[model samples]
Target: MMDLLRSLLFVLLFYPGTLLYVLTVIIVSPIGDAPVQAVVHAWSQFHHWLVRNVLGIRIVWDGAIPDGPFLIAVKHQSMMEAVDTLHFAQCPVVVMKRELTVIPLFGWVTRRYGVIGVDREAGASALRTMMAEARAAVSGGRPVIIFPEGTRVPYGTSPPLRPGFAGLYRALGLPVVPVAHDVGRLWHRGFVKRSGTVHFKVGDVIPPGLKRDDVESRVHAAINALTP
Candidate 1:
C-alpha cells in the first residue's frame, strides 16, 4: 500500500515536472546549446531527486563513470537508466530510435539537444547517418551513449546485442565503456516501483579496432556481468 501510494505520487509529479522541463528546453533551445544543456541537466537532477526521495530508491556506483569521448554501451533493463545517464554524464549524445525523435514538442527539444536518432528499419542508410552524427559528436568531445541491447528487457535476461551496435562501434573507433546495472529488479515497466538500491557497475574500457566478434563478445559479457 505504501509502495502504491508512492508510485502514484511519483507519476502525478513526473508528468508535470517533465512538461515544465520540456517547455523550458523548447524555449531556451533557440538561444544556444549551452542553455538547452543546462535545462537538461536540471531536468536530470529533478529525476534523481524524485527517484531518491519520492520513490525511496538509491543509486550505487561500483566503478568510475567514464569521462571524455568514448562509446558508452549500457545494459537496458528499464527507463530508469535512460534518465540516469543524463545525470551521470556531462553532455552525452544519446542514440535513440527515430520514433522517439518524431514525438511532438518533446522530440523537437531532443533534436535541438543533440540526440542521434536512428531508423532501425532503414537498413544501411540508417547506420551511415548514425555513424556520421556519432563522428561529429566525438569530434566535439562529447560521449556517445547507446543501449546495445536496443530495447529494455526484463530483469535476469541476457540478450544478444542488436547488430547496429557493432556497426557503430566500428565507425566511431572509440574505446567502449560497458555499464551494467540492476535497475529492473526494482523498477519494472509498470507504475508500482519498489524501493531498493540500483547498482551500476562500469566495466574496463574495451579498445577500438578489434574484430567485430571479439569486441561484441567482450562487451556482451561485460554489460551482463552483474545480471543474475
Candidate 2:
C-alpha cells in the first residue's frame, strides 16, 4: 500500500518535472553547450531527488568512472542505469537508435547533447554514419556509451551483444570501459521503482586495437562480473 502511494507520487512528479526541464532547455539552448549541460545536470539531480525522497532509492557506485575519450559498454537491465550514466560520465555522448531522435522534447535534448544515432537496417551506411559521429564525439573529448545488448534484458538474463558495439570499437580506436550493475530487480522496465541501492560496478578498461572477438568476450565478461 505504501509502495503504491510512492509509485503514484513518483509518476505524478516525473512528468511535470520533465516538462519543466524541457522548457528550461529550450529557453537556454541558445546559450550553448554549457547551459545545456547545466540543465541536463539539474534534470538528473531532480530525478535523484525523486528516487531518494519519493521512492527511497539510493545509488551505490562501485568503482572509479573513466575520464573521457573512451567507449563504454554497459549491461542494460533497466532504464535506471541509463539515466545514471548521465550522472557518472564526464562529457558523455551515447550511441542510440535513430528512432529515439524523433521523441519530442526528450529527443530534442538528445540531439542537443550530440548523441549519435544509428539506423540498424541501413547496414554498411549506418555503420559509416555511426562511426563518423562517434569519431567526432571522441575527438571532442567525450566518452561514448553503448549498451552492448542494445536493449534491456530482464533481471538474471545475459544476452549476446548486438553487432554494432564491436564495429564502433574498431572504428573509433578508443579504450573500452565495461560497466556492470544490477538495477532491474528494483527499477524494472515496468512502472514500479522499488527502494534500495543500485550498485554500478566499473570493470577494467580494455585498450583499443584488439580483434573483434577478443574485445567482445572481454567486454561481456567484465559487464557480467557482478551479476550472480
- Identify the leading candidate in terms of TM-score: 1
If scored against the real structure, what TM-score would every candidate get?
0.97, 0.94
- Residue pairs in collision within model 1: none
lDDT of 2 by residue, 1-228 (tens): 676788899999987998899889889999899999888878877887888899888778788876767888889887667766777688688887788877888889888978888787898898889889998888888889899888888878888888889989998898988999888778786776788777878998899999989999999999987677
Error of 2 at 132 (Å): 0.9
> lDDT at 69 for candidate 1?
78
The per-prediction tally of clashing pairs is: 0, 0
lDDT of 2: 0.84
| Model 2 spans with C-alpha error above 4 angstroms | none
Candidate 1 lDDT score relative to the true structure: 0.90
lDDT of 1 by residue, 1-228 (tens): 888998999999987999999999988877988999999888888988999999999888889876777899999988788887886677999998899898998888889889999998999899899999999998998999999998899999999998889999998899999999989999999889998888999999999999999999999999998899
What are the lDDT scores of the predictions, listed in order?
A: 0.90, 0.84
TM-score of 2: 0.94
